[model samples]
Target: MRRKQAGIALITAVITAALVAALAAWIAWRQQLWFFQLENQLDQGQARAIAYSGVQLARFTLRDDARNNQVDHLGEPWNVPIPAIPVEQGKVGGRLLEQQGRFNLNNLISNGVASDNDIAACRRLFELAGVPPQRVDALVDWLDADGETRPGGAEDAAYLALPQPYRAANQPLTDLASLVRVQGFDAETIARLTPFVSVLPPQTPINVNFAPPEVIAAIVPELALAEAQAVVSRRAGRHFASVGEFIAALPERVRGQLRPEALTVQSRYFISEVDAQFGRVTVRYAALLERNGPDFPRLLWMRRR
Candidate 1:
């Protein structure tokens, strides 16, 4: 009887020991997982902080540029790309681009009315991109407040008839991605036009010093693509000091087609793109900055992507 009791006690003790060992192993695993998660969170926070600092640096650069020069151009310091620099355990880099370099979509309408000159410029851009120029009429209709659709344009009725019925925005585009929603603008057209077009505040003029060759050609009627390319290439060493200078460089015949009202040598809006990596985390930051006169640039909007 004593032997049987001794055997039972031994079995219980072994089972208890096994249970304890399993519990210890599980606790250790949980602790390791928790530590890993905590480390990732810390790294992510550091990366985000670093990105924010990069944007502040870009703002400072713009402010310094404003103090030193009245003209904004590709040759200026503000347009220089920030090379990747090592941080404590990671790296950061950024670049600033003037938004005025592209054709402003909001320029299509002003003061609750359609602007003829801006429409014509946009049409030219569309034709240059090989997309139907009539697409601009659809864009104008989308931006205009009235329900009456322009020729070859879409309105509430047209959209409502679709399988996934939705109404026209009837307002200025705040985000260029919204272009895909407008009638006659598919993904392919948006992709082609993205590089030359931008959504900025109403009536913002294109800065000729930084405008792409295609945009320059669009804004200047009768200017050949090769001529536009020549104009842009010449800016590599010297930038246009004023609208008058840009017009003077053009051929005398096409010079008359250029309108000074829709062009500028300086810019008011800029984009700051910053990338930061810390440990295993990476952060992408983008912001729209507005510089008013000589004052420091103000952050219009910011996003992390």
Candidate 2:
């Protein structure tokens, strides 16, 4: 009877030890999972904060530039790219681009009236970019207030007739990607046009001081690509101070064809592209900024990807 009791006690002890070991292993696994989740959440929040900080930095840079300089040019300090700067366990980088350097697509319409000159300029831009100019009419009709379809353009009636159809916006484009809704524009054409065109407030003029060679060529049809490139190169060393100075620098033949009012030395719109990386995660932000005067730059919009 003593031996039997001893054996039974030994068996009970072994079973209890096994149960304790299993329970401890389970608790450790749960703790590790919770820690991992907490770390991931912290990383995401940190990345987002870093991106917003980058945008604010850009805003300050633009405000400072506006206060100090009268002319916005490619050579300005705001145009300089920001190298990646390490923060507490992460890094952030960004660059500012003058939005007025590209032709504003909304310029095609003014006060409910379609401007022939603006349309022609858009056509020239499309031609220069090797995109088919056939879509120009569609864009005009899409933006114009009237429902009447222009030749080769689509209206509500035309779009509704398609297999998977929707109505035309018939208003100013809020975003550049909205161009895909207009007839004759596809993702490929938009990709080609994206670098040189912007969707800004209607009637915004293109800033000649920072305009790229392609945009300059589009604006002044008489100027050859090489000539526009030369102008850009010259301006890099000595920025154009005024529309008159820009016109004076142009060749005599091209001078007469250029429109003075369509050019500007200053810009109100800019884009700040920022990238923030934390651990294995990366966040991209595009902040649109508008500076009207010496005041701090206003955040127009922010897009994250």
Candidate 3:
């Protein structure tokens, strides 16, 4: 009887030891997972902070440029991209882009009406990009306040007819991504046009000093793409100091057709992008800034991801 009792006791002790070992392993695993999660959160916080600091750096540079320079161009110091610099745990980098360098889509409509000159310019731009110029008509209807749709346009009714119904936004676009909501604009089309076009406040003129060859050609009627390329190539040696200088440099044939009022040598709007990475976490910050006269650039909007 004593032997039987001893054997039963040993079996119970062995099972208890096995349970204790399994519990210890589970606790260790849980603690390790918790540490990993906490580290990732810390890395994310650090990366975001570094990204914001980079934005302030851009703002300071733009403010200095406003005070010192009369014109914004590719040759200016503010146009240069900041090389990646090592931070406490990782690196950060940034760049400034002149928004006025691209054709402004908001300029297509003014005072609740479509501007013929702007429409013509956009048509030329679309043709140059090999996109259907008819897309412009749809864009116009999207911007115009009235419900009447143009031949190639879609209004509220058309959108409501979709399988997933929505309404047309009869207003100026706040960002380039809004183009996907407009008729005839797909991801591919918007991507193709992004290099040459922008969505900025109304009446914003194209900054000739930084505009691409396609934009230069579009704005200057009768100017061929090759001639526009030559114009851009010349800017490498010396940027245009004034609209007059840009116009005078154009081919004599197209000079007569150029609208000096539709172009500028100065930029009022700019985009700043900064990236920061820490550990396995990365963050990107983007901001739109507006500078007027000798004042510091104003932050219009910002996003971090």
Candidate 4:
């Protein structure tokens, strides 16, 4: 009976030992998971701080450029892309683009009236981009204060007839992406037009110094694509000093078609982008800035991803 009790004790000891070993493993696993989460949180916090630093750097660069340079152009230091700079366990990079370089979609409407000149310019842009001209009227109708639809435009009545009915905005576009909601505009068209257009404050003129060759060609009806491209190429060697100088460079036929008031060498709107990387994680920040004269630049909008 003493021997039997001794065997039972041995079995109990073995079982207890197994349970203890299992508990230790579980505790170790839980601790490891906690450490991983902590590391991730730390990396994310660092990345966010770095991204904001990049934004401040962009703001400073823009302010300095505005102070020293009378004109904003592609050749300026501000236009140069910032290469990734290594930091503690990570890196950051960014670029600044002048938003006024592109055509402003809101230019279609002025106050309460639809400007014929602006509509013509937009139609020309769409034509140059190979987007269907049929959608142009709908865009005009969407922004015009009145409900009266243009010949090819869609009003509230037309939208209501659709399977997924919605109302016409009948107001200025707050965002460029809002184009998708306009009649006859699809994802494909929006994608095609996005690179050449922006939704800036109403009445902003196009900055000829930074506009792409295609946009230049669209803006000047008489200017051929080749001629626009030539102007862009030449600007690299000698940037246009003023709108007058740019007009002088154009062919007489093209020069005659351009309205001096519709062009400018300066830009008020800009986009700043920062990409921050930490370990295996990455964060991005994009901010839109509006610089009015010598005053400090204002952040109009910001987005993070």
Candidate 5:
């Protein structure tokens, strides 16, 4: 009878221990779940706030940087006018680069005659950069009004060999990316040269006051380093005060090529990019912007998010 009683007590004790272990495990599981939920909520909240704050910070940083120095939308500095704007997305931030500050590649072959100094520079630049003479010549032919191909430009004969059916090819370069299609240029080459070039509406001249050193070399390869340096020295404390002022700034040899009517301050496109990471997450964005600005900066266009 005593043995039977001890056996019942052992059974009861075993059952009680099982129930206690199960209960403790349930509580620990719930705690772990709640801890994860809290962490996730905090991370999302912080990410959203960081993305928006990035915009404000970009504006502040850009203005201060521009004021401190004179570089335009490109990385190079100048003595001419430049503006700043705020940009950000998903924890990343950057500034919109104003494309108007540089010479337009579209001007390379305007009309039957390449009458612009910008045209000369573009040719000279492409040549010095080791762009095949044939490709540079092809660009000139593509720029001309007539169907006749220049010495190196693509013609009807060349186009017929390709997959597309086309006639005379005289379209302006739509973007810096378009240059990659030019013969002798590959992804690597485009990456190297895109910074020194811009694609604006037809007939846009190179802004002499803000043209970079490479651009200066491209414009007039004959331009000795001293002459380009002199151009920079003269630009300080003055802006092409007017179109006429800009014309007067050029050297006598290159002076005749400046077409006053073709120059303007307005720009039709810009480029901006953003990259960000918050904790385990990362995001990147690239876009094109188109807005003219004397004061306020705003978005005119954007690419996919």
Candidate 6:
């Protein structure tokens, strides 16, 4: 009887040991999953908040930087500066750009008309940047109010000669990407030119306080690259106090394109970013608050990374 009792006790002990081990393993697994879930939730919430805050910061920075988005914290203006990259899984950061600092799209045909000087300037700018003048000349022909192609430009005749079908953009460019559609305008070259030019209203010239080095060189033909760099460097963390003050920083030719009214201390666009880490996500927004008004920031672009 005593031997039988001993056997029963040993079996019971083995079952209890197995059950305890299984319970411990299950608890560890649950803890690990909970930890990860909590971390993911925190990151998501933070990213959403940071992206929202970025929009506000951009609006504020634009206003503080004379509506020039390139201004860094040091008060130095940038022409086509790269944005800050994201770090720390859940952190968010972004760079702001000002459209007015670039060559105005409307500059293509000023005041609903094209002028010889403007055409020459545009052609010269493309040439200096290594673009074929023939291509730019054709682009201008398409931009003109009439359908006639200018001399040295591509027209329907030229288009027909090409194997690939092509169409002229007879109307104004509604977006900045239209440049690649022009003949001889490749994506590589356009990407390089993006820093210097803009597709904004043609009547507006670049704001001196915000003009990138490329715009400075394009606007003021006489300006050496160093001279343009100097203008950006010497501002001592400040924007040009007036259009005249800004002109003084330019070469004689750049002065002609600028006007007193061209200076603006307001912001028209902004980029807000948010980063989250169930993976990563980034959202960008453009803010339009030309006047003092109350409105929640609106969404512009959303990207997940």
Tens digits of lDDT, candidate 4, 184-274 = 8889999999888999888898888888887898889867778999999888898888999898888887778887888999888898899
* Candidate 1, 1-305: lDDT as tens digits: 99999999999999999999999999999999999999999999999999989989988888888888889887776677888899999999999978899999999999879999999989989888888999998888899986475333446777888899887777889867789889888889999998899888899989988888899999998898889999888888899999998998887899877668888988989889999999999999888898887788899888875
Per-candidate Cα lDDT values, in order, are 0.88, 0.87, 0.88, 0.85, 0.56, 0.59
- Tens-digit per-residue lDDT, 41-139, candidate 5: 666555555544443443444444445544342233322222322323234544555565555777775655665565566666666556543566666
Ranking by lDDT: 1, 3, 2, 4, 6, 5
Report lDDT (Cα) of residue 154, candidate 3: 46
lDDT of 2 by residue, 197-289 (tens): 999888888898878888898888678888989888888889888888888878888888877888899999998899999986789989889
Q: Residue 233 CA error for candidate 5 (Å)?
A: 3.9
Best by TM-score: 3
Give the true-structure RMSD of model 5.
Answer: 8.9
Per-residue lDDT, model 3, residue 79, is: 79
Candidate 6 global Cα RMSD: 8.8
Candidate 6, residue 251: how far the Cα is off, in Å: 6.0
Residue-level lDDT of model 6, residues 117-223, one tens digit each, is: 55665665666677776666666766766636543334755665678866565666644567777666779878767766766435654566666666666666566
Of models 4 and 6, which has the larger lDDT?
A: 4
- Per-model TM-score, in order, reads 0.89, 0.85, 0.91, 0.85, 0.55, 0.59
Prediction-by-prediction clash tally: 0, 0, 0, 0, 2, 3
What residue pairs clash in candidate 5, if any at all? 121-219, 138-153
Name the candidate, 1 or 6, with the larger TM-score value. Answer: 1
Error at 193, model 1, angstroms: 1.4
Off by over 4 Å in 2: 1-35, 149-154
Instruction: Check candidate 3 and list the clashing pairs.
Output: none
